[model samples]
Structure formats: structure tokens, C-alpha cells
Target: MNDALEIDDLTLWLGMLEKVVDGSTNMVVVTDRERRIKWVNATYSRVTGWSLPECIGKRPRELLHGPQTSAEELSRLASLIRQGQSVSNFELVNHKKSGEPYHVALNIEPIRDAHGEVCAYLSIQSDITERRQQERHTVELKQRLEVAQRLARLGRIDTEVETGRPRWSSEVFRILGMVPDEAPREFEGLLAFTVPEDVSDLRRSLADGVEAGEELDVEFRVIGRHGQQRWVRCRGVPACEDGRYTLPRSWSVQDITFYKMRLEEKRQRNEELNQLVLARTRKLEESNRALEEFSCALSHDLRSPLRHVAGFAHLIKENLAKGSVDDCLGFCDRIVQAAGRMQNLIEGLLSFSRMGREGLNVERVDLDAMLREVVVGLHDDAGLRNIQWRIAPDLPAIQGDAVLLREVWINLLDNALKYTGHRDISEVEIGWHPHPDGPVFFVRDNGIGFDPEHAQKLFGMFQRLHSEPQFKGDGIGLALVRRIVESHGGRIWATSKLNQGATFYFLLPNIADSAMPSDWGAVESVHAIGCRCGDSQAVEPGLQS
Candidate 1:
């Protein structure tokens, strides 16, 4: 009776095992020692589209393996099974009865009898095709994100405040001029890379943002490991959990050195443009003042010469009417003298007007040669006076209009000769010195000079520091000299004190440095050096006499 009960109990146990296998979500297969399919649960048939009867005599590999399956994996699985070894989670591509491929993660165990020999093999598998696809998609997305960051010159950082641990992405390491393994553990350590001038501000921004749990935005400079200075814009926000600040704070950083350089260039250009406008405005104001002065000169100065002629002619008429023959001849001589004076005045005005309207014919002009020519022309005017011309041997050749430049030398030298009329021995020195921006030329004279206060007014049209009786001039020579100098992109100024010698200075750029503008109407292209007259401090020692 005990033997009969054991048989019934075994049958009940077998039935229970079969029911459990069929009810399972995982596909299960039981194979004999020969690797042939002995039995398969309902899930196996439902998953592979093959019934138990059709799969009973066939091997699992023969029914499920497809062209997409890995041959090496199948070989390894077979070798392990022959050794009676169990394999877990062996993944491979498997095909269904309908010829569709799917991914499978398989687990197999060796079933042994009481003799300790393998009798059959049990296999369990789970369909994981969707899970594998999801994992692959996640990896592809991460790769794309990294590529995007690199292209944008952008980097990312994550820091846990509580642990003081920081995580840097590969791009962040590159931006900081370091390798990934060299990333700082604490965020504060990153401050070492910041430039000294910007470090304090960056530190304050970080501290305030972290303390208040607010968004952080700042632009600062960083000196990388390679010692390259670059600008970077950083933005970050603290992570929140349950309405409270969490540990990790995230940030995005981007290199902005190129943008900053472009902005600086733009700002410089704007400043230059503004200066040009102001210079043009000043030139206009000067021109207007000159115009008003010219009108006054015409009405007052020219009219005086005309009135003198009319009065002299009337006196001569009265002398003739009174039959005073000798007195009439004297009146006639005075009228002739007045007419000559008026002619000189008209000629001076014509020359001054021409200086403004004429365009410059710029070329290399030898001042040494030009000076000798001017001195030779003044021989008759110098007469028997003991005059000495101390011309510097090393006078530079400059780029300017030859005709206008010669006029400059003539006017200056003539004035020197005229002012030194009272001197027993007249000395005129013309010399030049090298300057960093250009060459400076000066004419020093031992002549009776005017007050230093009137130096600036000496350049105005028809502005004469001396009266006609004091100096025989039409008050236009110096003004013409100034116009010619300015048109050639040079500057002229004089310094003097009463009864002392006067010195006139002018600067002309070298040929290589000359950047004469095509339009000289506004005269705005000239470089402005300090034009303060009588300011000994403004004059360089080399420029001093």
C-alpha cells in the first residue's frame, strides 16, 4: 500500500509542475539528453508561433536560430550544454515560426537523475527586444548631446553642495584646458582658474546664488591651464526637492572671447567716429570766425587805403587851385604812395584767398634745397645787413606740396628779416629733429618779438600783431603760412616774449607715415599734437632752441 501511495504522489507532483510552467509569463522548454525538444509549455508556443507537437522532435536551435543570430554565441551555448553546465542570461537573436527576428535573454539549467548523469535540459527565456532598443536609443541620444556641446563651445557642471563633490563633463574639461580626470572635486577649487581681477566677483556671485537658492548669471574671465586668457559666460540654478534647495547645482558655460573682441572693436570705432565729428565741428567754428574777420578787414582796412587816396587827391586839387606848384607836387607824391599801398593790400588778399581754394600736389620736397633757393631770392631785400642763415645740415625731405611749402619758407624768413631790422647782426636758424610720431621743424630768429599772449591770434586771416607803420605788411603772410601747413597734414605754432627772440615750430609726418586724405576741405585728417603756445612744458627738449 505504501508503494501505491508513492506513485500517486509523484503523478500529482508532475501535474502541478506542468501547470505552473504553462501559467508562467516566461517561455519554458524541456529537452532530452540528445538536445531534442521533449516538451514545451504554452508560453513557448505562443512566443515562437510553434506548437508543442511540431517542436517535439526538433532541437531548439534548429527551430529558433535565424540568419541574424550570432554563430559564435550559439557555438558557446552548445559547448556549455555538452559539458552539462548551466548558463544564465545568454542573449542572442532568435526567429519565430513566421520568420520575424526578436531579441531573447535565455537561462538554461541541466536536469540530472538519481545516478548523477544529465537526463534533460530546461530553458527559460524573456523577450527583451523593446528594452534593448530603448537602451540603444538612450546611448545614441547621449552621443548627440555631447557632439552638440562640443560644436557650441559649451560645457556643463554639476556640484553637490552637501558633499562638496563636483561632476564635470568632457566638454567642461576641454574648456578649462584640462583633462577629464583633473576636474576639481569642490566648486570652490574652480576659482583658481579665474583671473585675479575677476575672481572676487565670480566668487561673490556663486556664494550669493547658492545661499539664496537663486539663478546665477555672470560673465568673467578665466586663465586656463595653458595660460590663455578667455572670456566665458556662465549661467546656473540650484536643484530643488520638496520645495527646498537640494544638493546638486547645475551650470552651463560657454566661451565668449571672440564675441568680446568684436564688441571692443566696435566700441573703438564708435569713439573714433565721435572724435572726427567734434574735430569737424571745431574746424567749422574756426572757418566762421575767419569769415567774420575777413569781412571786417575788407570794410575797415581796405577802406582806410581808399580814404587816404581820396583825401590826398583832394589836397592836390586844392593846392593846384591855389596855384602852389611845389605843394601840389608834394600832394601828388603822397597820392602815388597811397595807390602803391592799396595795390599791395589787394595782392596780399588775392594770395590769401588762393591758399584756401587750391588743392595740394603732394610730393617729396627737399627743405634744404628749398631753403637755399628762398635765401637766394631774398638777397636784394636783405641788402647789406649782416644776416646769418644757420640752416641745419641734416634737414629732412618731407611729403608735401612743393609750391605751398616754398611759400611757407619765404613768409617765415621774410618776417624774420623784417623784424630784425633794428638789430646790428641778425641770426636765423632753421633746423629739425626726429620725433616718434613725425619730424619736428623749427625756425628760430633773433628778432624783436611780440607779446606771448597774442601767439594764438597770429594765425587768423589778416591778423597782424604789429601795425602797418611798425612792420611793412598787409597782415596776411602768417595766415597763409598756417593754411599751407595745415593742408599738408602738419601743424604750426609760435612762441615769443616782448623784445626777446621768437621761435616758430611745425611738425610734418614722414613719407612712410603720411596718410593724407583725398578730401582736404574739412582739414580733419591732420593729427592733432598739443598746440598750446608759450607752454614750455609742452615743448620737447629736442624741439627747444
Candidate 2:
């Protein structure tokens, strides 16, 4: 009777355990030490679509995995289980009875007998496909967000409030031309990268925000590794804890280099254009006033002399026909000569005025040939008086108006010859040299030079350095040369020492050629001049005699 009661109580306990295992949602299976299935719950059959009869005498591998399962994983699992160890929450893929793949989170535990010998293995598996998919989606979204930030020229930085530790994103390191490992570790170290002019302001702003727990929006400049400065705008939000800021605060910095550059360029261009327009308006008003004065001078001063010459010449012809004396003949000759001088002066003035108003027809001209012709013409002139001329060989061709440029050469060569008429052997040298930026052409003369202080007025309209008796010129030649050279985008200046010599130099910019580093410095100097061609102050006065 005692043996029967023991067997019956054991049956009742086994039945209750089986009922609990079958009703659970997790699939449970028991395997022998050799990994052969010994017992399986009803939930296992429902989940795997395999009945007890089919799985009873089979190993777990045969019932769960086919050729697609990893042999290495199977070897590892067996090795662990034989050592009396268990693995929990391990992931695996297995095929159901219908050949459909399912992902599971598996937990395997060792079952031991009373003699402390491992007899079976208990495994519980739960479906985890949806959970794994959600995790993957979260990771993909984070990667996309980082990409968007990089495209926007933005970066994020985090700092520990208490320890002053700093961390920068990959984009931040890229913007600063630094690697993450090479970046600064502390907030002060990072702030050192900011330009010295901006560092104090940045520190003040950041401190204010941290102390008061307020949000910050600040713009500052930083010198990058390439020595190029860039502008950045940073916005930060502080995380507070009990009136004190702790860790986990972040700020976003965006590169505003392009925006700042555009604004500065626009402002500069507007100012330049405004100045140009104002200067042009002033020039037009002066020209109009000069024209009015010339009209009045022409009608009164010039016409009176012409009328006297014409009236006297007719009287001389009539007196000759009526046997007039020698006195009448001498008076006629004086009137005619005075009128001729007036005519010459009027014509010269008209030509000078027309030079600035006319447009040039630009073309490539052989400067050597042009200078040869000018020298030949000066040699033939009656007033050229023992002049010695030197012209360079193989001078390069220049893009200019032939007619206008010829006029320039004529005026310069004529001045050299006429001014040095009193000298024993008047020397004039005309040549060109190639500069790193462009070409520099010069005309030097050993003549009666003027004071260096008056060099600024040499190229002004109607400016005369010499007295009328000493150098008899209309004083419009140099001004005309200036207008012509400047109209072709060139510059002109004179260097002289009194009683020694004078050298007039001019530069043509590289309009269709590559600019060198030397060009930058020269261009800076060129822009410093307020006037484009002739002296701004000299345009108002009438031409000196």
C-alpha cells in the first residue's frame, strides 16, 4: 500500500507540471544530455508546427534546423552545454515545420538528476522579429540625421557642465580640419581655437548662459587650420538640475562663412559704385562749366582779333591799288601774324578738348614701328634743335587706338625736342620693360626738369611748370596723354629732379592675361589714386600759355 501511494503522488505532480508548461506562451522543450528531445510542451508543437510523435525520438537540431543553419553555432552551443553552463537571451533563426523562417530569443538551462549528473536541457523561446526590426529602424534614422546635419554645415557639441569635459561630433571635427582624437578635451582647450578677438566675448556669453540656465544664441569667428577665418553661429540650451547645471547639455554650430562674405562684398561694391557715380557727376558738371567759359572766350577774345586782321588786310589791298605808303603795308603784316597765332591757339584748344570726349578704336599696334615714325617726324620739324633720340629695338605690340596712341607719341616726342632746344645735345630715350604684373612704358628726357613737389600737377589739364618765355607750349599735351592711357585701362606718373631730367612712366594692366602675385600689390596702389586719368584738381583751370 505504501508503494502505490508514492507512485500515485508522483503521477499527480508530473501532470500538474505538464499542465503549467503547456499553458505558457513561451515554447518549452526538454532535451537529453546528448541533445535528443525528451519532452516537449503543447506550446512547442503550436509554435514550431511539429507534433509530439514526430519530435519524440529526434535530436533538437534535426527538428529545428536544416542545412541553412550555421554549423559553427551548433558546435559552440554543444561545447557550452556539455560544460554544465547555460546561455540565456541568445538569438537564433530556425525553420518551422512549414519551412517558414522565424527569429527567436532563446533561453537554455541545464537540468540535473539527483546524482548531480546532467540529464536534460530546458529551453524557452520567444518571437522577437518585430522588436529587432524596430531597433534597426532607429539606427538607420540616426545615421540619416547625421548626414542631414553635415549637409547643412552644422555640427553638435556636448560638454559636461560640472567637469568641463567637451565632446564634438564628427562634423565639428571636419569643419575645424581636425580629427576627433586630435581635438581638445576640455572646454578651455576648445575655446582656444576661437580667434583671440572673439574668445573673450564667447566666454562671457557662455558663462552668462551657464550661470543663469538660459539659452544662448551667439555668433563668433574662428581661425581654421589653413589660416582662413570663418564665421560661425552657435545656439545652446542648458540642462539644469536644482538651480545648478549638470551634464548633458548640447549646442549646434553652423558655418556662416558664405553669408558673411556675401554681405561684406555687397557693402563694399555699393560704396565703390556710389563713389564712381559721384565722381562722374562732378566731372560732367565741370566739363559743362568749362565749355560755357570756352564759348564766351571764343566769341569775344578770338573773334575780335580775326575781325581786325580781315579788316586790315582788305585795307592794305585797297591802299596798294591806290598807291598807299610802306607804313600801311607793315601794319597789315602785324595784323595777319597776330591773327595767325590766335588761330593756332584756338585750334590747339579744340584738339585738347576733343581728346577726352572721343572714344578710341582699339587694335594691336607695333609700338616699335609707331615710335620710329614719331621720331622721324620730330627729326624733320624745324624747331627740334640738335635732339638725340633713342628708341628700343623689337618693342612688343600693344592693344590700343592707333590714331590716339600716335597722337600720344607725337605730343611726348615733341615736348622732349621743344623743351630741350637750348641744351647742347638734347637726349630722349623711349623704351618699355616687362613687369611681373604687366608692361611699363617710359619716356625719359635730359631737359630742364622741374621741382619734385610739382610732379603731382604734371599731367593735369592746362598745368604748366615752366614760364611762357622759357618753354612755349599750349600745356595740353600731357593731359591728353593721360586721358588716352587711362581710357585704355592704364596708369601714368612722372618722376623728375630739377635741372637734371624727367622720366614719365605708365603701366598697362593685365586685362586678358594671367595676373601674378606682383599684380596684387600694384593693383592696390593703383586703386589708391582718387582720379582715374588727369589730376582731379587740374581739370577746372584753363590751359596755361
Candidate 3:
């Protein structure tokens, strides 16, 4: 009878609380210290499809959360309530009794007893399923807009109508040759980069557009980063408040440099075709001058090697006449070495001639394994044993001739080793620099480097920066490297400080030989290596047969 009376009293109190919580939209829950649900507002039954008696003894998570609910948020909620504190704006994913997922923001507080001890926890849950979905949709649209602008080669800028101070998109900054997120400077400061002839007209058009609330469009030239000339087109559309108070005007800028360049090239080509007959005489004269330079360089370089063979041959004859067998053998060795030097030079010349006349035998080349083989061959040399070698992994594969590309690595690595022979602990690194143009391969070595002033001469035939005895070469190796790289539509250069390390860089397109360099198949290619006649030099010491 007493249990029956207690049940009657509890039912009466629940009815009163339901009337108090009438029209409240939040799903309110009350759980004891053991997390058994003691009471739930009518909103919880309406939202979850569970009646008061059905959820009277269940934990909230078991009824409303599943695999997708955030474990972190649940842990945080438990910690806050156990510490007799309140947690607001905590987000969690929950499910209805139908197993449909929804998002909720929880505001929870711990209910205290008379002695300040925790008794039950009260949680107010606000459903935010639609709001979270809207936020995700907004992000997706923003991303699509950015991609579209980039693909159109267009960028936007907004400028205050009176001051002309600008706010730019990332692409706008790129179009203007400024770094993204860079600090802003005065708008007039940019005029210094604009071509003087076009600046006044461009400014006048923009100012006129702002004053009259008219559309503006113009094209102008400006000096870009690194002093490169670029042409850009700007179109402006203005916005106003109350049809009179002008605000920031939106400007669309496009990089039209390539289009202008194409027009100029088409015109020049037309003129070239019409004047072919007149250009022939000038071409022949230029050809004649180039041939003389090539002949001079070959004659000068060959003379020294040939003279060594002749002079040593005569010395051998003298030693025989004196009946000195030991001296004669030594002179014979020197004669053979000089002959071998001459043979290598002739071979290089023949190879270059063939490279010019023949089309590339292009094929896929696996660079990483091939370089491993190249490094192994270099390690076979006793002189390079003490050097530290670093080869970057996962070098990209390129399509080119196996023979020519192999030669590229051989010449570069050989030069690195030769130049670094002086250091007690030599170091050489082979890596690549990737950019929008293509991959740039570099061979860096800690060596006795050359003076920067003579860098331009390093790739010329028989050009030696050091003395004859200090470093030995006909100076043909790097010239050979330059020849092969240019043939593959690539460029080669070097940088160094004296006595410090040097890095030699060569950039090759992804598919080499796809677009050959100018004068690619020229018959008289020897002129590419022609330079002032200098003393005859041999290959690196110990390179003789």
C-alpha cells in the first residue's frame, strides 16, 4: 500500500513538471550519478520517439548516440558534470530512435544536493542539424569560385573610390607580381612599375570611371618581378550607396602578356617570310664569322696536344741515341698519353656532330635506378672513395635517350669529383629543384671553387680558370654537358664562391627533346663551344689510356 502511494505522488509531480515545461522546445534530460535517466521533458519524447517510461532508466548516449557520435565530446561532457560545473556550446552528433543522425549543441549543468554534493545532471540539447549542413555548403561554394577564377586567368581587386587603396585576391597579387599576404603599400607606388607611356592614360580612365560611375576598361604594360615586361587588362565596375555615395569599386585584372606576345610574333613571322631573300646574305656573313671563330679554337686546342706527341717523340729518339733505355721508355709513355688525349677530343667532336644531325631516340628512362648505377661506377674510382655522396631518392622518370641522359650525369658527377679532389673530407650531393617549368637537377660539391667573374667562361671550349698543373682539362667536359643539355631543350648553369662549394644546375622539360632549342640541328655546331684561343690543355690527370 505504501509503494502504491509513493507511485501516486511521483505521477502527480511529473504531471506538474510537464505543465511547467509546456511549449519548451529543448530536449531536457535528468540523470543520476550512475547516469540512469530519472526524468525527461516532453520535448525529448517528441524528438526521440521514446516515452517517459521507456527511457526512465536508460543512459542518454545509449538511446541517442551511435558509432558516429564524437567520443571526445562525450568525455568532455562527463568531466564537466562530474566536477559540478556547467558546459555550454558543446557540439555532438546524436540519433533519433529511428536511427536518423542529427547535430546538437549541449548546455549541461550538475544539480547539487543541500550539502553541496552532486546528485543529478541536467542537460539542455539544441538541435543544429540544418545549420551545420549549411556551413559545409558555404565552404564548398567558396572553393569552386576560387578554382573558376584561377582557371579563367582572372583576378579581382576592390579599391576605395576616393583613396584608391586596394584589397586584392591572391590571384590579383600574383598578376601584379606581388607576393600573396604581403604588407600593403600606397596605391601610387605601383605606378613606378607601369610603363611611363601607359600610366597616365590608365590612371585617367580609372579616375574618370569612379567620378562618373561608368564602366572602365584598359590595357597597359608594366615591369613585373625580376624586371620582366608584362601586359595586363583591367575592367572595373563600380557600386554605390543611395546612388550617389561611392564605395569600393570592383576591378577585374587579367594577365594578357602571352596574348600580346603571340600577336607580335605573328607579325614578325609575316615580315620574315616576305624578306627571306634579303636575310640570306646577312645569314651567310654571320655564318662565315662564326666558322672563323670555331676554326681558331680547334686549331689552338689541337696544337698543344699534337705538339706534346711530337716533342716527346723527338725526346725518345734523343734518349735512344744516348743509349739511355730508362729515359726512352719514360718519353714513350708521355707520347702515348698525349695521343690518347687527342683521341678523346676527336671522339667528343664527332659525338657532338652526330647529336646535331640526328633526331633524338627518345624513350622512358628510370632515373633513380640509373643514377644508382652511375654512382656505383663513380665509387669504383679509387680517388672518390673518401668523398661523401648524397643522392636524393624518388627522382622523377623522364623520357629521353638513355645514352645522352647517362652522359649528362657522367659529365656532371665527374666534374664534381675532379674539382673536389683538394679537400680532405669531400662532399657531393645530387638533388633536384622542381618548379612549374620542370625539374632542375643539381650536383653540388665542396671543392676549391672558381671566381664568379669567370663563371661565363667555364662552359666554353678550352676555358680553364685554374692553372694548367693545378686543374687539368681541355675545358671540354662542361662544354659537352652544355651541348647535351641544350640539345634536349634544357639549360645549364653554375654558382659558387671561391674555395667554397659549387652547384651545377640543369633544367629539363618533363619530356625532353619535345621542343628543341634554337639552332638545334645546325650543321656547324662547333661554334657553340668557340672561344678565344688559349694554351692547349689535357684532360684531368690520370685520365690517359
Candidate 4:
């Protein structure tokens, strides 16, 4: 009877243990030495969708692992188990009987007998799929936050009131050029990165703020390890401690180098603008002065020619009453000449004004062809026949407006023809010499040249050196030529001596045709006085290509 009572108690205890295992939500599985599932709780069946009857003789890997399981992980697990070791919280890829994959935190313990010999293995598995997914989501959020902070050139600074210690983010290390693991973690540590002069103010600011519970806000400069300077702003966040100075507080740090640089640029630009305004003001003042001079020239020069025409007309009418037919015709010719002189000055004014408004089209101009065209146009002039032309071969091309350049050639060449009109054997040379900035093309003539002393006043409009009778011009042609050369981004100047023929040299910008570097410099304005073709001594037209 005692044995039966004992047996009934044993049955009751075993039944209670089974109920405890089955009631829990955790999955429990027992495997024999070969890792074959010997027993499994109801929870395991629910989680894995496999009944104990089906998995009883199967290994956990055979029931849960498939192709998606990492082979290396499986091999590691197998090696550990074969060594009679316990695998605690070993992460593994598992599949349910429904063929859906899930991650599980599996803890497997080796059951030992009294001799400590491994006999069986018990495993506890928790559904950690949600936990792992949460971890991945957290990582993504952290990455995005870091990216945002970096783009703003922002970092954080934390200080502990109790320890009087400081902490810097990785970005601060970049600003100060310090290694994070070895970075100073105290107030003194900041002195290494900050300028020595600023350390005291920074320390005072922090001390006062901490003591008074006021948020710290300041800008400071950091001298990196490489001695590069960077500017940063620090704005403190409240510690929010309850009268506890031991709490930690933080300040936001951002690199304001770019902002400072922009401010500096703005100041410089303002300075430049102020100077430009002053220059323009001076130029306007000069223009007013020039306008007054123009008025004087107009009144005197125009009135002189008009008076001559009038006087000649009055004299011709008086002489006609007392003279023969030939004498009357001669007086009539004088009147006509005066009218023609006035007409030339008027035409010069028109040409000068027109060139000011002419549009410029820059291109590679075949100067040889342009000069040839000038020659063709002037060929019809009766005086060009006496002047012999010596044009250099293989003339280099230049960059300038086609129409403007052609006009330049016409004026220069026509001037050459007129100045040499008195020569029985006149020679004109057109050639080029290479210069650092560009090529200088010249038109030289053996003709009556003026005094070099008066060369300075040559290019002004209506400034004539010789009388109209000596050379038939209104002193407008050289001025026009200078204007054209200046328009083409070029320089023009004449070299002459009394009686020696003049050589007018000019340069045009190079847009094409050679490997020479085009160094653009400012072109100075030049002028020619009166262009009269007469004689002195002839210089060898030793022209260079």
C-alpha cells in the first residue's frame, strides 16, 4: 500500500512538470547526442509548425535550416557541438515548416551525466526577429542623423560639471585635428586645439555659465594641429538640473569658416566699388573739361573756313567787274577751294561720330587680303600710280572686325599715297614684326614727314600741323585710324623725323593662326597730326617679316 501511494505522488509531480513546460510561451527542444530531436514542447510545435511526432527523430538543422542558412555558421555550430560545448544565444537563420524564414536567438546547453560526459542538449529559442529588425532600423536612423549633422558642419561638445571634464564628437576632432581616443577630455584639453589667447575667455565663459546656470554662447577660433585656422560657434543647451552642479551640459558646435570668408569677400568688394566710384567721378570731371575745349576748336576752326569762302566770293564778284575771262575764272576757283575745305571738315566730323557707334565683329582677318582690297579701292585714285608698293610676302593674319580693319588699311594706305605724291620715285612698305603681345603690322612711306616735336598733338580731331594748301586734309584721317585701331583692341603710333618718311606701326589681337600666347594688355590711345606727303632723306625700307 505504501509503494502505491509513492507511485501516485511521482505521477502527480511528473504531470505538473509537463504542464509547466507546455504552459510557457518559450520554445524548448531536447536533442540526443547526435543532435536528433528527442522531445519538444507544445510551444516549439506552435513556433516551428512541426509536431513532436514529425521532428522526434530529426536534427534541429534538418527541421529549421535550409539553403538560405549560412554554411560557415552551420559549420561553426557543428564544430562547437562536436566538441561537447554549449552554444549560448547563437544567432542562426531558421525556416518554419511553412517555408518562411525567421531569425532566432538560440541558446543550447549540453546535458551532462554524473561523470560530466555529454549526453543530451537542451535548447531555448526566443522569437528575436522583431528585435533584430528593430536594431537595423535604429542603425539606419543613426546613419541619417550623422549625415545631416555633417552637412551642417555641426558637432557637439559635452562637459561634466562634477569632473569639470569635456567630451568632443568625432567632427570636433576633424576641426581641431586630434585623434579621438587620445583627445583631451578636460578643460585643459581644449587649450591644445584653441588659440592660446582665446583659452582664458572660453574658460571664463564656461565657468560663469556653469556657476550662474546661464546657457553658454560664444564664438572661438581653433588652430588645428597642422596650424590651419578655423572658426566655430558654440551655443549651450540647458543642463536642466535641479540645483545640481554635477549634471552634465552640452554645447552645439558648428564650423562658421565659410560664413566668415563670405563676410570678408563682401568687405573687399565694397572697397573696390568705392574706388571705382571715385575713378568714374574723376573721369566725368575730365570729360567736362574736354567738352569746353571742343567748343573752342569748333568756333575757331569752322569760322575760319567759312570766312575764307565768304571773302573769296566777295572778292571774285569785285574782280569780275574789272577783269578778263581768265582772271574771273581763277578767282572763282579760289572760292570753290574754300568751300571744299569746309566740306572736308564737315565730312571728318561725320566719319568720327559714325565710327564711335559702329558695331565690332571680331574674327580672324586675312590682313593680306584686307590690304589688297584697300589697294584695289585706291587703284582708281589718280595719284597711286607714282607710289611703288612693297608688301611683305606671307603676311600673318590678325583678329579684328573685317569692316573696321579694312577701313584702317584704307586710311593708312591712302595717307601713304598722298604723302608720297610729291616723290618722283616713292616707295611704301607694308610688313609685320612679331611682338610679345601680338604681331605689329606697319605701313612705312618715303614722303614729306613733319617735325617729331609736334607728334604729341597729332591725333586730336581738327589739329592740323601743315596748311591745307601743303597737304589737302582736314587733320581727321590719322585720328580716324587711331580710333579704329583702338576699337580693334590695338595700339598705333608713328615714328618720324623732319623730312624723313614716317612709319606707322600697329598691333591687333590674335584670335587664331599661331601657338603664341595672347597676353592682353591695355591699349593706349594715339593720334596723328597732319598727314602731308613731302620729302626729306629716305631711310632704307629694311622691312622685317
Give the per-residue lDDT of model 4 (tens digit) for 1-545.
22323433433533554576876787888776688877788988998899989998898888898877889999998888888887888888889999888888878888765456666677888878788889989999878766877788887776655765677767777777766763436434554688879889987876777777666677788898889999988776446656655323566778899999998999999999999999878757645644554575588767887887788777777777777466667767877877787788778777766765566887777777778778767867754366577775556676678887887888888888778788887778776655555677778888887787887567777777677677877777887788788767777777777567778777775646473323222111111111233312112133222
Candidate 2 has a TM-score of 0.56
Prediction 4 TM-score vs. true: 0.54
Worst 10 residues of 4 by lDDT: 521-530
In candidate 3, stretches whose alpha carbon ends up further than 4 angstroms from where it belongs are 1-15, 158-166, 177-179, 182-197, 222-229, 241-248, 266-545
Ranking by TM-score: 1, 2, 4, 3
Pick by lDDT: which candidate is best? 1
What tens-digit string does per-residue lDDT give for candidate 2 at 321-377?
899777696877879776776876687678767765778787777777888987887
The backbone clash count of each candidate, in order, is: 0, 0, 0, 6
Q: Candidates' lDDT values, in order?
A: 0.77, 0.72, 0.72, 0.72
Error of 2 at 269 (Å): 7.5
For each candidate, what TM-score against the reference?
0.73, 0.56, 0.44, 0.54
**Per-residue lDDT of candidate 1, residues 41-157 (tens digit):** 888899899998999889988899999999999999889888888899999999999999989998998876656677667789999989999999999998998899888878777
Query: Which stretches in model 4 have alpha-carbon errors above 4 Å?
Result: 1-158, 169-230, 233-254, 264-293, 316-332, 515-545
Q: At residue 315, what lDDT does model 3 achieve?
A: 85
Whole-model lDDT, candidate 1? Answer: 0.77
RMSD, model 4, all Cα superposed? 11.1
Tens digits of lDDT, candidate 3, 1-545: 22322333444644665677646898888777677888888888888888889999999877988878888978987787767788888999998989988899988876555456665676788888899999989889878877787777677776546766666667666766778774554334445678878878887876777788776677888887777788877776657777663423566767788899999999899889769856777656644643553575588867778999999888888888998888887888888888888887777666655654577788888887899899888878745369788776566678777888898899888888888888887788776644445666777788887787888888776677888688666676777688778768788877777887677778777644432224433312321211111102111122222
Q: Give me candidate 3's TM-score against the actual structure.
A: 0.44
